[model samples]
Target: MTSLFPTTLFRPAAAVVAIAAALAPMVSLAAEPFVLQDIRVEGLQRTDPGTVFAALPFRVGETYTDDKAAAALRALFATGLFKDVRIEIDGKVAIVIVEERPVIQSVNFVGLKEFDKDVLIKSLRDAGIGEGLPFDKALVDRAEQEIKRQYLSRSLYGAEVVTTITPTDRNRVNVSFTMTEGDAAKIKEIRIVGTKAFGESTLKDLMDLTAGGWLTWYTKNDRYSRAKLNADLDTIRAYYLNRGYLEFAITSTQVTISPDKQDISITITVQEGQPYTVTAVRLQGEYFGREDQFRSLVTVRPGEAYQASGVAATVKAFTDLFATYGHAFARVEPRTEVDRATGQVALTLVADPQRRVYVRRIDVAGNTRTRDEVVRREFRQLESSWYDGERIKLSRDRVDRLGYFKEVAVETNEVANSPDQVDLVVNVTEKPTGNLQVGMSFSSADRLAFSASVRQDNVFGSGNYLGLELNTSKNARSLVFSTMDPYFTVDGISRSIDLFYRTSRPYNSLGDQYQISNPGGSVRFGVPFTEYDTVFFGIGLEQTNIGATAGIPNQYFDYRFRYGPRSTSLPLTIGWARDQRDSALTPTAGRYQRVNLEWSAGGDVRYLRSNLQYQQFFPIGSKLTLGLNAELGYGKGLGGRPYPVFKNFYGGGLGSVRVFEQGSLGVIDPTGAYIGGASKFNLNSELYFPVPGTGNDKSLRIFAFADMGNVWREGERLDAKSLRASAGFGLSWISPVGPLKLSWGTPLRSQPTDRIQRFQFQIGTAF
Candidate 1:
């Protein structure tokens, strides 16, 4: 049957060629005249005759051969205005007939629930099928296929499409594509076949592709895609190669479907060749100068096993070292010699520092969404100057730091016209920077709380930020509007202004609580001290009002008598920070430090508060990273007075320590409830590793974490040695949408009153 299929497919091609040759003889045998005296078009709606005549291959009084007629037919068909085309000759005159496809009166949709109707319409228009336009069978077929693809992308694999073609009274047709989108196919089980060095569970864990999990319902990673499978295979190949399996090869990969077409299984056959150890490494060829300096850059040891990562690192280090000496055209290639019998490998690195070329022009390409200045400003290696690899890398990093583009890359191309000068092409891919968050929470006393906020990080692709946030819930009310210009001055000084109002009901489980509201605004200015550091100063004014409310905790509220609707207070704030994390979502190596101090001279709640946080990351080996974070904060009233409730820090949930209940990490009253106060300390650490089966070495990582942090009253002295602690394990996947995180933490110092949290999962998290 398989052999017959290929033969059947070739039959039509053979027949067409044979017919064309056979028909040539009949043309010679025909008695018809060869020349036309005049030409006229019989049918053409909303089309000019001059246009058709101009398109004709043969002029009037010219020979009308078979080729000419075929050309005429093809020309008319290519216009996309005709439903049918025919050329008839009578004596010496030729008649052109065309039944033009109707111009669309209007294209619209009603009750569109599956896809955005306007977006669909735009796609159809781009496909040459839309309202107020002529159409052909080819266009209709293409439109249907495109619509199906869009639906499939949305996971509507079982969707059915029906087209309706209705002719109107005015020589027009109204085309409608009605769709019945059925439910999507949910993945049941993902199985990998063939011989394996690792177990199925271990292999599965290494895959970014999953069967079904909590996020699967949304991200649909479980859905099958051939492109995704190929990418995953490359990931698997990298994993083995980096681990010293130099001879690993994937023989074949197969994706099978059941009769129902809803279930799928993937099987990959791999040849796990014997692992090799590095016996020797030799550097040959020109070293330009300072051979010792280059030798120091070598991280691969002679006796160490062959690792792809080490090989790449050596290449990069060599290249950068050459660039530092103005050798931008340098090339370094590592050739491996493998001994099959002994399973040993030898690496020889050859360096050729070619004629150094200066950059004559730096061109920005493929940036349709971003302004030219936004990208050009990040250039550190200026044109008409010698190229420096370090500068180029820094320029690329600067562009990526804007957060406007998902990916930024630089390609060096030798200018064809000029050999001594190279043209640098900066490529950028933009991502959606607008975010909307709407969520609701329910508690025993607070029936249901709702909160929503919207912000745009990259406004107009200029790298500016604007946000209008609103949070209205049971105990908290806030409205904040802010704008930030990252490049307010050409010197890189950023300025920000914030307008905000907030009202809070300081809740206490006991019957002595108070209702306090603070409403105000602020203006801040920031200065970039260095590439990894920034400092900011701000001043704000707020009016505070405090009132007693029943049902508040008596032990805390009675002592803190209500006093508010007080005069305006001048509050000052100063902040400094630096971040060097590899990834904001999951740091591999770097340090992040921040310190902020705020003080209010006048208000119902006046106090001096300071917060300091520091995070450090280190690479344990090629495959693991260790991260540590610590935070300390304290608040003290200027005069002999009580600590401000608003200055208090609450821990728990995703951002804080994840083991305890939300808002339950702070000081508690007799009822074991959170009472507003200030003074806190926290410590956390995590060890991250690549998930076993996930072919992605960088995209997915698993971590075991320990968190130790808590909040205490401001009047009470803080005991750093007595901090609360929580320990747990979690998974981190660098998903396309964001970082997907899931952790289950348990309190290390469990008290009788502490609530234990388990199986806690969060999507799109940042640390």
Candidate 2:
């Protein structure tokens, strides 16, 4: 028994040099092999002794040589638990002496307002520095730089980070990062150089990044971000390319910050080559024997100027068509042949159908609260079916329309070692589908209105809807409870049930004592005919009670006398609706149409009522949209009886021809009450634009509108002269509580007897 290896310290700071020095002693002990009787570890504080024992290459009673000792040392250092390691051998015992790195007691941040503390903590933890872990000086330094880099991304060029390490008892340390974040640097100037075909201002207008503007504070477009600048450059390049500048190129871009780092200047240099015309568009490679049909999808015309957008569209269409035929990996590349002398380009769409594949499986992820079945039931792309791009896209849209998720995405991944099979992944980010709202609104007609609703669109993650709503206003009060099962029959058919009680008092009514009370319940079923169309049918039983008071309208009194104070009606309703809008909350494009018919053939009331509505929106530009809406209503007696006065249609208000009081455009009773009519027609046109300080946010917009409509009695002739017209401007906002609309209308054509209300507003209503 004798000392074989001398104790030598190894530090990671200079691992190469320290390991070389420590190994020098081990070489002398290599020739002498010893049988270890015991192994002991020193400098144990927070780390368990078993951790060191597990990493050792040799155990007690095993023969230990220089190679095993060196292996053990390397393994121990790799654990990152110790900052210094030394092995001492005395006779038949091996002593592993180590200096453990300080465990992080706490990691704190000071003056951290730009980012959440937890976010920064997680970032630091990912970088190997956090509470409950060994502290590394190099990692701490790197983390400081990373923090500064994050601030720089937010345009805070003057941001500075200082890391402080404080040692505490029990081999623990506290780490604190103090940040001094100054003002953000803004783009003071942006210039596009080498632009001759178009004005510099015009080209700059196409870029999202811009100099300081009134809206820059909110939009942050003036912030100097490298990613944003790159995106803007792409937008500029696309603009030129779409305008026939086939050889347009961004030669160079220069971004410079001021000495104080408070202002930044950007200059983009472009090479706008000569514009080219399309000589011909030829299809090459393979068309799967559908050459003629593929040719019809080509959007690049031979006689038209060369447009990159057209070429891109043609390529996408070709690939999409191929995908519909089970070619999941179709590739369509546009090969351009340019004739410089003639300034003409010949575009050839090269298609490669590759290998046809079918879906092997459909996987869903990212739904924590909602059940997986809720999302899977919406998919039309079935497993083990031929891959259809159109069906996959439809499935994504269908899941998105459910409103249970914030984001719904479908991705196709090729299966490993299976070229003929692919897997479809549906990723959904679930959002809160339950809403409890209590709100108040005001309007010229309804001075004060209160509303409360408890709704769950995805009740218990079952994809069912349950809601209870209560609304009270000066002219109307209603309480309704409803529920809907979207997959009632598992064939995309829906079923809905509603129970409601309503009380209504006409505008200009003398008192609340005279009113109409109606209570009803209905069960409706929706049958889907197409992707965007649905037909609904339902039956309802209602009882109407007309109250009598002084100064009551003659029409209502006469009706109650003939039909009795209480009248019961059994009504059958059928409706058809088609929604093709890009968004239900903020529609910028597409059309929506609806038609409803209600017929009461039994009980004390017998009549037929029909209503039709059409709406269309046209996106004029990036920030502007035009919308048009038309509605018509008609009612008639079916059994030689007069149409129910209590079932009349009303017009004029924020929803109809504004500037006229609510429900004041119909026939007026001799008692001065506004009695609505059985026939109504309304038309509306609106131009919507982004608010001045809101940038491209569609949630806030300003619109100019023109409304024209009137209500007439069932037997009365629909007179053009009687129609009321108004023009006005309004503000629309999708607020946290609900959709809010404020309008100020001036009557362009109004009768002297008509009640006028120039201003009106409401919440939770949409056009």
Candidate 3:
């Protein structure tokens, strides 16, 4: 039994009713039957008198009995509008005394970090604990328990919730909930029992859930999650089923948490059945009598180990093939017949491709931020057209590439009463596209460089990108602001605006450490030529000034003498790129090519610059990848003007010829310093392998690379024998901050005049 009154003095006098039982009399005193002359309610501040009168069982001028008194008490308590109730009869004059429950004025959350305050308020409201509602002590206690359960699901088992209530005017009160969620419980060990066919390590490798590790802090893989464990069990089942152990099963799984709730242990038991071999495969379905066409798509071969993946792949292939021809409702069913004596299985693939359907409508959903048109314009398939699976898939991928969403999926719903018509629904879940980055790094050349950037790829959900970057380095400094709209026009045309102020010093130790200051702005447009290709062209105005520094190079003084201390150029740029990579971040097999050409004809430094790059990736195995890259650059002075010294190409860095000091290749001045040249060539080959103990995580990898490149000054004869070569090993990690690369290389071919810098590490970008 719980007391209804909050005060201890009143609680002892008030009746305590058990929720599991019916209401009973609190006092033994009984009243005889009498006619009621009047009935009145008292002690209500916010509740109306009519509300109490309507709830009373006995009315005015009615005969009140003992049964009626108990009935009235039970009826009034059921309403939960009163915390205290009493009835008195003064010679046929009945009076009702009541103390109304406090009305909730506000509900607030304090010290909440794991969940948003608004979300918590909404959940409480759904549980009948909101403003203007009658507040009950029991309901408040239940709310606290529910909140604790939510934290426990997130592995925060050591969470505490405290609730407070403050009395207010008009019989109202304010409720506040404070929370403290401790650290998540982590898995200390995972043991798998009854594994005889495969090694224990091999079985564990198939699961994404693992024990504690260094990367667990970021990945949270050690946290105890029931959903993740279930998913891992499914993965294990698939692993065994794919390898001919079709009858494998997980007998039991146990999860044990430590007393302090900081460490957890997990154990799994499994059973492995006899392996089965595939005897034959046959098709048994309505394929429009095109048996031979369907047979050609089967990936499962006879006399091989029974492979569940092979059968599943063949099913998907059949379904996709049917969908291409407007059969959106096509179904493929595979039935297996086994022989215990021979340990052989025969698979019968049954498919039922229903009537061809047409798209009746296209609906977009789950995009609460982005405009509907922004998603609709990316779809290649049109409404009211025959359903095509290929275009639908491409549309989903295109939306994904926008980088505004974390997930994108397409669903087909059959139109009711219209067998030949279906509706396509596109679902997208939005993610945060705005990023504030603070970067610091140390390199051989720039000992300590600091950088910061504010970028929003989907500004205000308008599909526009805006960025501002600040770089602090003694050798190079830049302040840039840029804006780009990917869908500037209806036909997939993009527009970009860029403004930058850059200053860089020569890499050489001699020549006074003179600097070049360049301020520029450009307006560019991108036109999509095909699904995987685009062409960009831009026009920009650049102004250059030779800084006043000590020990100015004689070439700079000569250039100033000939063309003054300032030069302006109106540059025209054009570029083309075609990427067919399976993934832009970590490609295992694909081809990429890009070419850019810049020409400045209306300035004092009239020159033509062109750069080309090509890359090809090959998958050595499921876990290994090989990549080859080559780049060639050429700049020539045009219109009788010299190629700008600030625009000259340079080699001998991670991006070019590694194992040498940055920009330490090319022609030498009179002071034994290597100045940048106008011609550059580079070739790189790398073999990437998985990181040890990381399984199939592509974000972390190790690679052995061989690099060869060189630089040549303008008017200097190009020689193949002058090229510098290096071979090394490097580690790459796509960390939370950014992509990090660390390399250690030894120069294989270096001349006496070359500067060597062996170790290099960089964050936030790839070389």
- Candidate 3 per-residue lDDT over residues 327-425, each given as its tens digit: 998999999998878889999999999899989999999999998888999999899898888888889899999999988999899899999999999
**What would the per-residue lDDT of candidate 2 be over residues 277-386, giving only the tens digit for each residue?**
99898888988789999999888888788888888888888888888899988999899999989999999888899999999999999988888888888788889999
List the global CA lDDT of all models.
Answer: 0.73, 0.86, 0.83
**TM-score versus the correct structure, for each prediction:** 0.76, 0.85, 0.79
Best by TM-score: 2
Give the lDDT of residue 439 in candidate 1: 70
Flag the better candidate by TM-score, 1 or 3: 3
Order the candidates by lDDT, highest first: 2, 3, 1
On a 0 to 100 scale, what is the lDDT of residue 348 in model 3? 96
Residue ranges of candidate 2 with Cα displaced over 4 Å: 1-110, 116-143, 164-177, 367-372, 415-418, 438-452, 470-478, 502-518, 543-567, 601-605, 637-641, 670-672, 691-695
Model 2 gets an lDDT of 0.86
TM-score of 2: 0.85
lDDT (Cα) of model 3: 0.83
